[model samples]
Target: MKYYQKALYDEMTSFYLITCDDEGDKLGRIRSLIGGLVRKARQVIGQEGDDKVRIHQLLQLFYGDWGFHCDPEHYFEAENLYLAYVLETHSGMPVSLGALLLYLADSLKLPLYPVNFPTQLILRAEVDNEVAFIDPWNGHYLSQAHLQKLYEGAFGFGAEISSEELERADVNTLLNRFRQLAKNALIRENRNDAAYRYIASLLRYHPEDPYEIRDRGLVLAQMGCYQAAAEDLQYFVDQCPQDPTSFLLTAQLAELKDHFSELH
Candidate 1:
Protein backbone atom coordinates (compact mmCIF):
# COMPACT_ATOMS: atom_id res chain seq x y z
CA MET A 1 0.00 0.00 0.00
CA LYS A 2 1.04 3.58 -0.60
CA TYR A 3 2.26 5.50 2.44
CA TYR A 4 -0.82 7.67 2.81
CA GLN A 5 -3.12 4.72 2.22
CA LYS A 6 -1.30 2.79 4.93
CA ALA A 7 -1.60 5.80 7.20
CA LEU A 8 -5.34 5.96 6.57
CA TYR A 9 -5.77 2.26 7.18
CA ASP A 10 -3.67 2.49 10.35
CA GLU A 11 -5.95 5.29 11.55
CA MET A 12 -9.07 3.25 10.89
CA THR A 13 -7.81 0.10 12.55
CA SER A 14 -5.94 1.79 15.36
CA PHE A 15 -8.18 0.47 18.06
CA TYR A 16 -7.33 -3.12 17.21
CA LEU A 17 -3.63 -2.69 16.51
CA ILE A 18 -2.92 -3.23 20.17
CA THR A 19 -4.27 -6.77 20.16
CA CYS A 20 -4.11 -8.03 16.62
CA ASP A 21 -0.79 -9.80 16.41
CA ASP A 22 -1.33 -11.31 12.96
CA GLU A 23 -0.86 -7.84 11.51
CA GLY A 24 2.80 -7.88 12.66
CA ASP A 25 5.15 -8.16 15.64
CA LYS A 26 5.11 -4.39 15.83
CA LEU A 27 1.61 -4.57 17.29
CA GLY A 28 2.90 -6.37 20.40
CA ARG A 29 5.52 -3.73 21.05
CA ILE A 30 2.97 -0.91 20.73
CA ARG A 31 0.63 -2.69 23.11
CA SER A 32 3.38 -3.01 25.69
CA LEU A 33 4.29 0.67 25.46
CA ILE A 34 0.71 1.82 25.91
CA GLY A 35 0.17 -0.60 28.77
CA GLY A 36 3.31 0.57 30.52
CA LEU A 37 2.35 4.19 30.07
CA VAL A 38 -1.16 3.62 31.35
CA ARG A 39 0.14 1.84 34.42
CA LYS A 40 2.66 4.59 35.12
CA ALA A 41 0.02 7.26 34.66
CA ARG A 42 -2.36 5.53 37.04
CA GLN A 43 0.35 5.16 39.65
CA VAL A 44 1.44 8.77 39.42
CA ILE A 45 -2.08 10.12 39.47
CA GLY A 46 -3.00 7.42 42.05
CA GLN A 47 -6.77 7.86 42.17
CA GLU A 48 -6.27 11.54 42.97
CA GLY A 49 -8.37 12.41 39.90
CA ASP A 50 -5.82 14.96 38.76
CA ASP A 51 -6.79 14.33 35.18
CA LYS A 52 -5.03 17.31 33.67
CA VAL A 53 -1.71 16.50 35.31
CA ARG A 54 -2.05 12.89 34.33
CA ILE A 55 -2.85 13.72 30.73
CA HIS A 56 -0.08 16.27 30.51
CA GLN A 57 2.38 13.71 31.76
CA LEU A 58 1.10 11.05 29.37
CA LEU A 59 1.45 13.40 26.39
CA GLN A 60 4.85 14.48 27.60
CA LEU A 61 5.94 10.91 27.83
CA PHE A 62 4.78 10.49 24.24
CA TYR A 63 5.92 13.75 22.61
CA GLY A 64 7.67 16.13 25.03
CA ASP A 65 10.92 15.84 23.07
CA TRP A 66 9.32 17.21 19.91
CA GLY A 67 9.48 20.93 19.11
CA PHE A 68 6.53 23.26 18.68
CA HIS A 69 5.41 25.10 15.55
CA CYS A 70 2.31 26.77 14.12
CA ASP A 71 2.59 24.73 10.92
CA PRO A 72 0.01 22.04 10.17
CA GLU A 73 2.48 19.84 8.30
CA HIS A 74 4.81 19.79 11.30
CA TYR A 75 1.96 18.76 13.54
CA PHE A 76 0.90 16.11 11.04
CA GLU A 77 4.36 14.57 11.04
CA ALA A 78 4.52 14.70 14.80
CA GLU A 79 1.14 13.06 15.09
CA ASN A 80 2.22 10.38 12.62
CA LEU A 81 5.31 9.60 14.67
CA TYR A 82 3.46 9.58 17.97
CA LEU A 83 0.70 7.37 16.62
CA ALA A 84 3.12 5.03 14.87
CA TYR A 85 5.13 4.65 18.06
CA VAL A 86 2.05 3.93 20.11
CA LEU A 87 0.70 1.55 17.48
CA GLU A 88 3.93 -0.33 16.95
CA THR A 89 5.22 -0.28 20.49
CA HIS A 90 2.18 -0.20 22.77
CA SER A 91 -0.66 -1.86 20.97
CA GLY A 92 -2.25 1.54 20.79
CA MET A 93 -3.75 3.09 17.68
CA PRO A 94 -5.23 6.50 17.64
CA VAL A 95 -6.76 7.95 14.46
CA SER A 96 -3.94 10.43 14.84
CA LEU A 97 -1.58 11.41 17.62
CA GLY A 98 -3.98 14.19 18.52
CA ALA A 99 -6.79 11.68 18.68
CA LEU A 100 -4.61 9.31 20.66
CA LEU A 101 -3.87 11.96 23.24
CA LEU A 102 -7.52 12.87 23.38
CA TYR A 103 -8.37 9.21 23.95
CA LEU A 104 -5.78 8.76 26.65
CA ALA A 105 -6.91 11.98 28.28
CA ASP A 106 -10.50 10.84 28.15
CA SER A 107 -9.54 7.56 29.74
CA LEU A 108 -7.90 9.50 32.53
CA LYS A 109 -11.05 11.61 32.85
CA LEU A 110 -9.13 14.63 31.65
CA PRO A 111 -11.21 17.24 29.87
CA LEU A 112 -8.98 17.48 26.83
CA TYR A 113 -10.16 18.06 23.27
CA PRO A 114 -8.71 18.73 19.84
CA VAL A 115 -8.79 22.38 18.77
CA ASN A 116 -9.87 23.03 15.18
CA PHE A 117 -7.31 25.61 14.25
CA PRO A 118 -7.46 26.85 10.65
CA THR A 119 -3.99 25.59 9.69
CA GLN A 120 -2.52 24.08 12.81
CA LEU A 121 -2.97 21.21 15.21
CA ILE A 122 -3.73 22.23 18.78
CA LEU A 123 -5.42 20.83 21.84
CA ARG A 124 -7.49 22.37 24.58
CA ALA A 125 -7.24 21.26 28.16
CA GLU A 126 -9.61 22.00 30.99
CA VAL A 127 -7.11 23.08 33.58
CA ASP A 128 -8.85 23.58 36.90
CA ASN A 129 -11.92 22.80 34.80
CA GLU A 130 -11.35 25.93 32.72
CA VAL A 131 -10.63 25.72 29.02
CA ALA A 132 -7.11 26.50 27.81
CA PHE A 133 -5.15 25.86 24.62
CA ILE A 134 -2.04 23.72 24.84
CA ASP A 135 0.88 23.17 22.49
CA PRO A 136 1.29 19.45 23.03
CA TRP A 137 4.57 19.21 21.18
CA ASN A 138 6.26 22.03 23.09
CA GLY A 139 4.30 22.04 26.37
CA HIS A 140 3.25 25.65 25.86
CA TYR A 141 -0.03 26.54 27.54
CA LEU A 142 -2.10 29.16 25.74
CA SER A 143 -4.56 31.44 27.45
CA GLN A 144 -7.88 32.55 26.00
CA ALA A 145 -6.45 35.96 25.27
CA HIS A 146 -3.49 34.39 23.52
CA LEU A 147 -5.81 32.19 21.50
CA GLN A 148 -7.74 35.27 20.36
CA LYS A 149 -4.49 36.84 19.24
CA LEU A 150 -3.58 33.67 17.36
CA TYR A 151 -6.98 33.60 15.74
CA GLU A 152 -6.68 37.23 14.64
CA GLY A 153 -3.25 36.54 13.23
CA ALA A 154 -4.51 33.56 11.26
CA PHE A 155 -8.10 34.33 10.24
CA GLY A 156 -8.52 38.10 10.72
CA PHE A 157 -11.30 40.26 12.10
CA GLY A 158 -15.02 39.40 12.35
CA ALA A 159 -14.30 35.74 12.97
CA GLU A 160 -16.88 34.80 15.57
CA ILE A 161 -15.34 32.88 18.42
CA SER A 162 -15.49 32.13 22.13
CA SER A 163 -13.80 29.71 24.47
CA GLU A 164 -17.08 27.89 24.93
CA GLU A 165 -17.64 27.95 21.19
CA LEU A 166 -14.44 26.03 20.55
CA GLU A 167 -15.81 22.64 21.39
CA ARG A 168 -14.04 19.33 20.82
CA ALA A 169 -13.35 18.61 17.17
CA ASP A 170 -14.17 15.12 15.90
CA VAL A 171 -12.44 12.34 13.90
CA ASN A 172 -14.05 13.46 10.66
CA THR A 173 -12.32 16.82 11.02
CA LEU A 174 -8.98 14.99 11.26
CA LEU A 175 -9.89 12.89 8.21
CA ASN A 176 -10.64 16.08 6.28
CA ARG A 177 -7.20 17.28 7.32
CA PHE A 178 -5.66 14.18 5.80
CA ARG A 179 -7.66 14.80 2.65
CA GLN A 180 -6.38 18.35 2.55
CA LEU A 181 -2.81 17.05 2.74
CA ALA A 182 -3.57 14.60 -0.06
CA LYS A 183 -4.90 17.47 -2.17
CA ASN A 184 -1.71 19.40 -1.49
CA ALA A 185 0.35 16.40 -2.55
CA LEU A 186 -1.61 16.25 -5.78
CA ILE A 187 -0.94 19.91 -6.42
CA ARG A 188 2.77 19.51 -5.70
CA GLU A 189 2.92 16.60 -8.17
CA ASN A 190 1.20 18.73 -10.87
CA ARG A 191 -1.67 16.31 -10.91
CA ASN A 192 -4.60 18.69 -11.18
CA ASP A 193 -6.86 15.81 -12.11
CA ALA A 194 -6.05 14.02 -8.88
CA ALA A 195 -6.35 17.24 -6.95
CA TYR A 196 -9.82 17.82 -8.36
CA ARG A 197 -10.80 14.28 -7.47
CA TYR A 198 -9.66 14.87 -3.89
CA ILE A 199 -11.68 18.09 -3.76
CA ALA A 200 -14.74 16.16 -4.94
CA SER A 201 -14.21 13.68 -2.15
CA LEU A 202 -13.89 16.54 0.33
CA LEU A 203 -17.21 17.96 -0.90
CA ARG A 204 -18.81 14.55 -0.54
CA TYR A 205 -17.80 14.54 3.12
CA HIS A 206 -18.65 18.19 3.76
CA PRO A 207 -21.38 18.97 1.24
CA GLU A 208 -22.91 21.88 3.09
CA ASP A 209 -19.66 23.79 3.52
CA PRO A 210 -19.50 26.79 1.18
CA TYR A 211 -15.75 27.07 1.64
CA GLU A 212 -15.26 23.74 -0.07
CA ILE A 213 -17.50 24.79 -2.93
CA ARG A 214 -15.59 28.03 -3.36
CA ASP A 215 -12.28 26.18 -3.25
CA ARG A 216 -13.38 23.62 -5.80
CA GLY A 217 -14.62 26.40 -8.05
CA LEU A 218 -11.28 28.17 -7.74
CA VAL A 219 -9.50 24.98 -8.74
CA LEU A 220 -11.82 24.57 -11.74
CA ALA A 221 -11.15 28.14 -12.75
CA GLN A 222 -7.42 27.48 -12.56
CA MET A 223 -7.91 24.56 -14.96
CA GLY A 224 -9.60 26.91 -17.48
CA CYS A 225 -12.96 25.20 -17.08
CA TYR A 226 -15.06 28.28 -16.51
CA GLN A 227 -18.36 26.44 -16.89
CA ALA A 228 -17.54 24.03 -14.08
CA ALA A 229 -16.21 26.89 -12.00
CA ALA A 230 -19.43 28.83 -12.60
CA GLU A 231 -21.52 25.84 -11.52
CA ASP A 232 -19.60 25.48 -8.26
CA LEU A 233 -19.39 29.21 -7.57
CA GLN A 234 -23.12 29.52 -8.21
CA TYR A 235 -23.76 26.85 -5.58
CA PHE A 236 -21.34 28.57 -3.21
CA VAL A 237 -23.15 31.87 -3.67
CA ASP A 238 -26.46 30.16 -3.08
CA GLN A 239 -25.16 28.61 0.10
CA CYS A 240 -23.19 31.57 1.40
CA PRO A 241 -24.81 34.72 0.13
CA GLN A 242 -22.73 36.96 2.36
CA ASP A 243 -19.36 35.82 0.99
CA PRO A 244 -18.10 38.57 -1.38
CA THR A 245 -15.75 36.20 -3.20
CA SER A 246 -18.66 34.02 -4.27
CA PHE A 247 -20.51 37.02 -5.60
CA LEU A 248 -17.40 38.13 -7.48
CA LEU A 249 -17.04 34.71 -9.02
CA THR A 250 -20.71 34.75 -10.01
CA ALA A 251 -20.26 38.10 -11.78
CA GLN A 252 -17.16 36.84 -13.54
CA LEU A 253 -19.07 33.79 -14.68
CA ALA A 254 -21.95 35.92 -15.96
CA GLU A 255 -19.54 37.99 -18.00
CA LEU A 256 -17.94 34.83 -19.39
CA LYS A 257 -21.33 33.39 -20.28
CA ASP A 258 -22.32 36.62 -22.07
CA HIS A 259 -19.06 36.71 -24.00
CA PHE A 260 -19.54 33.07 -25.05
CA SER A 261 -23.07 33.82 -26.12
CA GLU A 262 -21.88 36.72 -28.27
CA LEU A 263 -19.33 34.50 -30.00
CA HIS A 264 -21.88 31.71 -30.66
Candidate 2:
Protein backbone atom coordinates (compact mmCIF):
# COMPACT_ATOMS: atom_id res chain seq x y z
CA MET A 1 0.00 0.00 0.00
CA LYS A 2 2.35 2.75 -1.22
CA TYR A 3 5.29 1.37 0.81
CA TYR A 4 4.58 2.51 4.33
CA GLN A 5 6.75 5.22 5.88
CA LYS A 6 5.85 4.98 9.58
CA ALA A 7 2.15 5.03 8.70
CA LEU A 8 0.02 1.97 9.41
CA TYR A 9 -3.06 1.77 7.17
CA ASP A 10 -4.93 -0.98 5.41
CA GLU A 11 -6.03 1.37 2.63
CA MET A 12 -3.38 1.11 -0.08
CA THR A 13 -2.33 2.32 -3.53
CA SER A 14 -0.46 -0.89 -4.41
CA PHE A 15 -3.31 -2.18 -6.54
CA TYR A 16 -3.80 1.30 -7.95
CA LEU A 17 -0.49 0.83 -9.83
CA ILE A 18 -2.11 -1.75 -12.08
CA THR A 19 -4.17 0.99 -13.72
CA CYS A 20 -1.49 3.65 -13.45
CA ASP A 21 -0.31 5.33 -16.67
CA ASP A 22 3.25 6.18 -15.67
CA GLU A 23 6.05 3.91 -14.44
CA GLY A 24 6.85 4.64 -10.83
CA ASP A 25 8.02 2.88 -7.69
CA LYS A 26 4.59 1.47 -6.82
CA LEU A 27 3.89 0.34 -10.36
CA GLY A 28 7.33 -1.26 -10.61
CA ARG A 29 6.81 -3.11 -7.34
CA ILE A 30 3.40 -4.29 -8.53
CA ARG A 31 4.93 -5.49 -11.80
CA SER A 32 7.64 -7.38 -9.91
CA LEU A 33 5.06 -9.04 -7.67
CA ILE A 34 2.77 -9.99 -10.57
CA GLY A 35 5.78 -11.22 -12.55
CA GLY A 36 6.75 -13.53 -9.69
CA LEU A 37 3.21 -14.89 -9.49
CA VAL A 38 3.07 -15.38 -13.24
CA ARG A 39 6.39 -17.21 -13.19
CA LYS A 40 5.21 -19.44 -10.37
CA ALA A 41 1.96 -20.16 -12.20
CA ARG A 42 3.88 -20.98 -15.38
CA GLN A 43 5.99 -23.46 -13.44
CA VAL A 44 2.80 -25.15 -12.33
CA ILE A 45 1.02 -25.08 -15.72
CA GLY A 46 4.09 -25.78 -17.92
CA GLN A 47 4.32 -24.87 -21.62
CA GLU A 48 3.24 -28.11 -23.24
CA GLY A 49 -0.35 -27.19 -24.05
CA ASP A 50 -2.45 -24.82 -26.12
CA ASP A 51 -4.21 -21.71 -24.81
CA LYS A 52 -7.28 -23.66 -23.63
CA VAL A 53 -5.24 -26.19 -21.72
CA ARG A 54 -3.03 -23.47 -20.29
CA ILE A 55 -6.04 -21.53 -19.12
CA HIS A 56 -7.49 -24.62 -17.48
CA GLN A 57 -4.20 -25.39 -15.80
CA LEU A 58 -3.90 -21.80 -14.68
CA LEU A 59 -7.33 -21.99 -13.05
CA GLN A 60 -6.47 -25.28 -11.41
CA LEU A 61 -3.21 -23.89 -10.09
CA PHE A 62 -4.82 -20.78 -8.63
CA TYR A 63 -8.13 -22.16 -7.39
CA GLY A 64 -6.90 -25.67 -6.53
CA ASP A 65 -3.26 -25.93 -5.57
CA TRP A 66 -2.94 -22.37 -4.37
CA GLY A 67 -6.31 -22.70 -2.67
CA PHE A 68 -7.04 -19.05 -3.32
CA HIS A 69 -10.64 -18.30 -2.51
CA CYS A 70 -12.85 -15.74 -0.81
CA ASP A 71 -12.01 -15.01 2.77
CA PRO A 72 -14.92 -16.81 4.39
CA GLU A 73 -13.62 -15.94 7.86
CA HIS A 74 -13.37 -12.20 7.49
CA TYR A 75 -15.46 -10.94 4.61
CA PHE A 76 -15.20 -7.18 5.22
CA GLU A 77 -11.62 -7.06 6.46
CA ALA A 78 -9.58 -4.28 4.83
CA GLU A 79 -6.62 -6.61 4.34
CA ASN A 80 -8.76 -8.61 1.93
CA LEU A 81 -8.62 -5.67 -0.50
CA TYR A 82 -4.83 -5.15 -0.20
CA LEU A 83 -3.02 -6.96 -3.03
CA ALA A 84 0.07 -7.89 -1.04
CA TYR A 85 -2.04 -9.19 1.82
CA VAL A 86 -4.39 -11.04 -0.52
CA LEU A 87 -1.43 -12.69 -2.28
CA GLU A 88 0.09 -13.72 1.02
CA THR A 89 -3.14 -14.93 2.63
CA HIS A 90 -4.56 -16.52 -0.53
CA SER A 91 -7.95 -15.22 0.46
CA GLY A 92 -9.85 -12.07 -0.52
CA MET A 93 -13.10 -10.62 -1.73
CA PRO A 94 -14.27 -11.11 -5.32
CA VAL A 95 -12.73 -7.96 -6.80
CA SER A 96 -9.32 -8.35 -5.16
CA LEU A 97 -9.01 -12.08 -5.89
CA GLY A 98 -10.39 -11.71 -9.39
CA ALA A 99 -8.03 -8.88 -10.25
CA LEU A 100 -4.99 -10.72 -8.91
CA LEU A 101 -5.61 -13.83 -10.99
CA LEU A 102 -6.62 -11.65 -13.95
CA TYR A 103 -3.25 -9.89 -13.71
CA LEU A 104 -1.49 -13.23 -13.74
CA ALA A 105 -3.50 -14.25 -16.79
CA ASP A 106 -2.55 -11.03 -18.59
CA SER A 107 1.14 -11.57 -17.76
CA LEU A 108 0.89 -15.19 -18.97
CA LYS A 109 -0.55 -13.99 -22.30
CA LEU A 110 -4.03 -15.27 -21.59
CA PRO A 111 -6.85 -13.12 -22.95
CA LEU A 112 -8.58 -12.39 -19.65
CA TYR A 113 -10.30 -9.27 -18.34
CA PRO A 114 -12.64 -8.25 -15.59
CA VAL A 115 -16.39 -7.99 -16.12
CA ASN A 116 -18.30 -5.15 -14.50
CA PHE A 117 -21.02 -7.33 -13.01
CA PRO A 118 -23.83 -5.24 -11.62
CA THR A 119 -23.94 -7.08 -8.32
CA GLN A 120 -20.35 -8.25 -7.91
CA LEU A 121 -16.95 -8.47 -9.62
CA ILE A 122 -16.22 -11.35 -12.02
CA LEU A 123 -13.83 -12.22 -14.81
CA ARG A 124 -14.12 -12.98 -18.53
CA ALA A 125 -11.57 -15.17 -20.29
CA GLU A 126 -11.23 -16.84 -23.66
CA VAL A 127 -11.29 -20.61 -23.45
CA ASP A 128 -11.50 -22.82 -26.55
CA ASN A 129 -12.23 -19.67 -28.58
CA GLU A 130 -15.34 -19.09 -26.50
CA VAL A 131 -16.00 -16.67 -23.66
CA ALA A 132 -16.06 -18.19 -20.21
CA PHE A 133 -17.54 -15.88 -17.58
CA ILE A 134 -15.65 -16.79 -14.45
CA ASP A 135 -16.64 -16.36 -10.85
CA PRO A 136 -13.06 -15.81 -9.78
CA TRP A 137 -13.98 -15.66 -6.13
CA ASN A 138 -14.89 -19.37 -6.31
CA GLY A 139 -13.01 -20.41 -9.46
CA HIS A 140 -16.24 -21.46 -11.15
CA TYR A 141 -16.94 -21.05 -14.86
CA LEU A 142 -20.40 -19.55 -15.35
CA SER A 143 -22.34 -20.47 -18.44
CA GLN A 144 -24.71 -18.13 -20.25
CA ALA A 145 -27.77 -20.04 -19.09
CA HIS A 146 -26.59 -20.04 -15.49
CA LEU A 147 -25.69 -16.36 -15.54
CA GLN A 148 -29.34 -15.38 -15.29
CA LYS A 149 -29.74 -17.56 -12.22
CA LEU A 150 -26.64 -16.07 -10.61
CA TYR A 151 -27.88 -12.60 -11.36
CA GLU A 152 -31.26 -13.39 -9.90
CA GLY A 153 -29.59 -14.66 -6.74
CA ALA A 154 -27.48 -11.52 -6.42
CA PHE A 155 -29.94 -8.82 -7.41
CA GLY A 156 -33.36 -10.35 -6.80
CA PHE A 157 -35.39 -13.35 -7.75
CA GLY A 158 -37.67 -11.51 -10.13
CA ALA A 159 -34.86 -9.52 -11.79
CA GLU A 160 -33.95 -10.32 -15.39
CA ILE A 161 -30.46 -10.44 -16.85
CA SER A 162 -29.66 -8.95 -20.25
CA SER A 163 -26.80 -9.31 -22.74
CA GLU A 164 -25.61 -5.78 -21.93
CA GLU A 165 -24.89 -6.92 -18.38
CA LEU A 166 -21.66 -8.61 -19.46
CA GLU A 167 -19.79 -5.39 -20.19
CA ARG A 168 -16.06 -5.04 -19.55
CA ALA A 169 -14.79 -2.95 -16.63
CA ASP A 170 -12.23 -0.21 -17.23
CA VAL A 171 -9.29 0.72 -15.00
CA ASN A 172 -11.04 3.63 -13.27
CA THR A 173 -14.12 1.51 -12.63
CA LEU A 174 -11.94 -1.12 -11.01
CA LEU A 175 -10.18 1.43 -8.80
CA ASN A 176 -13.51 2.99 -7.81
CA ARG A 177 -14.78 -0.43 -6.74
CA PHE A 178 -11.67 -0.89 -4.61
CA ARG A 179 -12.14 2.52 -3.01
CA GLN A 180 -15.81 1.86 -2.29
CA LEU A 181 -14.99 -1.41 -0.60
CA ALA A 182 -12.80 0.33 1.95
CA LYS A 183 -15.12 3.33 2.15
CA ASN A 184 -18.14 1.19 2.96
CA ALA A 185 -16.22 -0.70 5.65
CA LEU A 186 -14.80 2.42 7.25
CA ILE A 187 -18.16 4.14 7.38
CA ARG A 188 -19.80 1.01 8.73
CA GLU A 189 -17.24 0.86 11.51
CA ASN A 190 -17.74 4.56 12.39
CA ARG A 191 -14.21 5.51 11.31
CA ASN A 192 -15.35 8.81 9.79
CA ASP A 193 -11.87 10.34 9.34
CA ALA A 194 -10.53 7.33 7.48
CA ALA A 195 -13.75 7.07 5.53
CA TYR A 196 -13.40 10.72 4.54
CA ARG A 197 -9.88 10.05 3.29
CA TYR A 198 -11.03 7.06 1.27
CA ILE A 199 -14.00 8.95 -0.22
CA ALA A 200 -11.74 11.92 -0.99
CA SER A 201 -9.51 9.63 -3.01
CA LEU A 202 -12.55 8.26 -4.77
CA LEU A 203 -13.78 11.78 -5.58
CA ARG A 204 -10.36 12.73 -6.96
CA TYR A 205 -10.73 10.00 -9.57
CA HIS A 206 -14.44 10.61 -10.03
CA PRO A 207 -14.95 14.32 -9.45
CA GLU A 208 -18.46 14.43 -10.82
CA ASP A 209 -19.73 11.36 -8.98
CA PRO A 210 -22.66 12.85 -7.05
CA TYR A 211 -23.12 10.04 -4.55
CA GLU A 212 -19.46 10.06 -3.62
CA ILE A 213 -19.55 13.82 -3.11
CA ARG A 214 -22.68 13.51 -0.99
CA ASP A 215 -21.19 10.70 1.10
CA ARG A 216 -17.88 12.50 1.47
CA GLY A 217 -19.71 15.51 2.83
CA LEU A 218 -21.52 13.32 5.32
CA VAL A 219 -18.22 11.70 6.32
CA LEU A 220 -16.57 15.08 6.82
CA ALA A 221 -19.45 16.27 8.97
CA GLN A 222 -19.08 13.17 11.12
CA MET A 223 -15.34 13.93 11.47
CA GLY A 224 -16.15 17.49 12.71
CA CYS A 225 -14.92 19.31 9.58
CA TYR A 226 -18.14 21.31 9.38
CA GLN A 227 -17.03 24.03 6.95
CA ALA A 228 -15.37 21.60 4.55
CA ALA A 229 -18.40 19.33 4.88
CA ALA A 230 -20.72 22.22 4.07
CA GLU A 231 -18.66 23.13 1.03
CA ASP A 232 -18.74 19.63 -0.36
CA LEU A 233 -22.46 19.33 0.28
CA GLN A 234 -23.11 22.65 -1.43
CA TYR A 235 -21.02 21.56 -4.39
CA PHE A 236 -23.00 18.34 -4.68
CA VAL A 237 -26.26 20.22 -4.49
CA ASP A 238 -25.20 22.76 -7.10
CA GLN A 239 -23.69 20.24 -9.50
CA CYS A 240 -26.60 17.82 -9.19
CA PRO A 241 -29.54 20.19 -9.08
CA GLN A 242 -31.97 17.53 -10.24
CA ASP A 243 -30.69 14.96 -7.75
CA PRO A 244 -33.37 13.14 -5.77
CA THR A 245 -31.71 14.16 -2.50
CA SER A 246 -31.06 17.78 -3.48
CA PHE A 247 -33.59 19.21 -1.00
CA LEU A 248 -32.25 17.01 1.81
CA LEU A 249 -28.68 17.98 0.90
CA THR A 250 -29.59 21.68 0.97
CA ALA A 251 -30.99 21.27 4.47
CA GLN A 252 -27.90 19.40 5.63
CA LEU A 253 -25.55 21.94 4.05
CA ALA A 254 -27.24 24.80 5.89
CA GLU A 255 -27.00 22.89 9.19
CA LEU A 256 -23.32 22.06 8.49
CA LYS A 257 -22.51 25.74 7.79
CA ASP A 258 -24.36 26.79 10.92
CA HIS A 259 -22.25 24.36 12.96
CA PHE A 260 -19.08 25.83 11.41
CA SER A 261 -20.20 29.39 12.25
CA GLU A 262 -21.01 28.43 15.84
CA LEU A 263 -17.62 26.76 16.31
CA HIS A 264 -15.67 29.63 14.76
Give one clash count per candidate, in the order shown: 9, 0
Q: Global CA lDDT of candidate 1, please? A: 0.57
User: How big is the positional error of residue 186 in model 2, measured in Å on the Cα after superposition?
Assistant: 3.3
Estimate every model's Cα lDDT from 0 to 1: 0.57, 0.71
Candidate 2 lDDT, tens digit per residue, 1-264?
A: 221111111224543333223433454555566577778987887655687778778888888888898967798876576665676678888877776776667657776777778768777876676787889778888887788887888888978877666865665655566666777766767767556656666667778887898788878888888987888888888888898888888888888888888998
Poorly placed runs, candidate 1 (over 4 Å)? 1-49, 66-100, 103-110, 117-121, 127-130, 151-161, 166-191, 205-211, 224-226, 238-241, 251-264
Please give, for residues 1-264, the per-residue lDDT of candidate 1 as tens digits.
Answer: 211212333442342342233455565565565566556656655545566666666666656432222234443332243344534433221235555555456546666766666645577776775776776444467776776777787778756566444666655665566555544544554556645765776567578777777767767766767677778778888888887776677777797566546656
> Model 2 residue 190 lDDT?
72
**The candidate that achieves the highest TM-score relative to the unseen native structure:** 2
In candidate 2, stretches whose alpha carbon ends up further than 4 angstroms from where it belongs are 1-35, 154-158, 190-212, 245-264
After aligning candidate 1 to the native by TM-score, how far in Å is the CA of 202 from where it should be?
A: 4.1
Worst 10 residues of 1 by lDDT: 1-10
Residue pairs with backbone overlap in model 1: 18-91, 29-89, 29-90, 30-88, 30-89, 30-90, 30-91, 31-90, 31-91
